[model samples]
Target: MTRKLTSQDAEALAVSALVYVANDPVLLPRFLALTGIEAPAIRQAAREPGFLAGVLRFILAHEPTLTAFAEHAGVAPAAVGEALKALPTGDDRYLAST
Candidate 1:
C-alpha cells in the first residue's frame, strides 16, 4: 500500500530536488543565476522560509527538468505538485488563503 505523504516527506523531496540541481553542471548555473544564491551560501539559504518551495517551483517550471528530477527521485512527476502543496509557502496555499 502507498503511504500517505507528510510535510516531512515534502521537505525531503524538496531537498532532493535542490541536491539534484546542485550536482548538475548545466542546471546548477541556471539555478544560481535565477535564485541569486551563491554556491557557498546554499546551505544557509536552505534554512530560509520559502526556499524549498522555490526549489520545487524551479524544478516544476520546466517540463524536462521536472521529468528528469522525477525520474532521478523515483517519484511520479505529480508528486512534485503534491510536495509543493504540502509546503507552507506553496503558491497554491498563498492563492487559497488570499
Candidate 2:
C-alpha cells in the first residue's frame, strides 16, 4: 500500500531536498541554473514564499530526481505535491501535481 504524507512531512521532504541538492555535485548545477540562485543565496532564497515548493517542483519535473530525493528522504514520491498544498504562500499558490 502507498502511504500519504502530512503537510509537515512534505515540508521535511522539501528541506531534505535542499540538503540533497547542496551536497550533490550534479544536481547542484541544475538547481543553480534553474533558479538562478548561487550557493550563497540559497539560505536567503529559501526563506522566500513558495521557494520550498519550487524546489519540490524542480525535482518533480524530472522523474529520476524525484525518485532519488524520495528514496533519500524516505517519503513516497507522491507526497511532494501534498506538501506544496499545505504550505500556504498567502496568495502565491504552489501547485505540485494536484
Candidate 3:
C-alpha cells in the first residue's frame, strides 16, 4: 500500500532528489538560481520540515538541470550538496507519492 505523505517524507524526497541532481554536474546551477536559496539557507532549510517540500515542488515543476536548479534555487552548488547530504534518505517514498 502507498503511504501517506508527511512533511518529513516530502523533505526527504527533496533531499534525495537534490542529492541525486547535485551529483549530476548539469542541473546543479539551475536549482540554485531558481530558489535564491544559498548554502546557509539550504542547510538551515534542511532542519526545517516544510521548506524542503516547497523547494522540491519548485524544482519538480521546473525540471531544471543541476546548474539550472542551483541558479533557480539561488544556492551555491556546494551548499546544495551539503544540504542534500544532511537530509534523510529513507523517506524517498514521497517521489512516488507525488
Candidate 4:
C-alpha cells in the first residue's frame, strides 16, 4: 500500500528539488535569478518559511525540469503537486477581493 504523503515528506522532496537545482549549471542560475537569492546565501534562505514551497513552485513551473526531477527521484510527476499541498502556503488560496 502507498503511504500517505505528509509535510515531512513534502519537505524532503523540496529539499531534493533544491539540491537538484543547485547542482545543475543551467537551472541554478535561473533559480537564483528568479528567487533573487545569492548562491552563497542558499543555506540560510532554505531555513526561511515558504522557501521550500517556492522551490517546489519553481520546479512545477517548468515541465522539463519537473519531468527530469520526478524521473530522477523515482516519483510520479503528479506527486510533486501533491507534495506541494503538504507544505505551508501550498494551497495558494487567494483572498477574495472586496
Backbone collision count in every prediction? 0, 0, 38, 0
Q: Which of the two, 2 or 3, has more lDDT?
A: 2
lDDT of candidate 1?
0.92
Report the number of the highest-TM-score candidate: 4
TM-score of 4: 0.89
Candidate 4 global CA lDDT score: 0.91
Residue 61 Cα positional deviation in candidate 3, in Å, after optimal superposition: 0.9
> Model-by-model lDDT, in order?
0.92, 0.80, 0.54, 0.91
Report the Cα lDDT for residue 34, model 2. Answer: 89
Weakest 10 consecutive residues, lDDT, candidate 4? Answer: 89-98
- For model 3, how does the per-residue alpha-carbon lDDT over 1-98 read when each residue is reduced to its tens digit? 53445444445556666675567565556657776677556677667654565555545455344456566555554444444334444236333443
Regions of model 3 farther than 4 Å from truth:
63-98
Top-down TM-score ranking? 4, 1, 2, 3
lDDT at position 39, candidate 1 = 94
State TM-scores per candidate. Answer: 0.89, 0.80, 0.46, 0.89
lDDT of 2 by residue, 17-71 (tens): 8899889999999999989999899999999878888888888889998888888
Clashing pairs in 2: none
Positional deviation of residue 65's Cα in model 3 after best superposition, in angstroms: 7.4
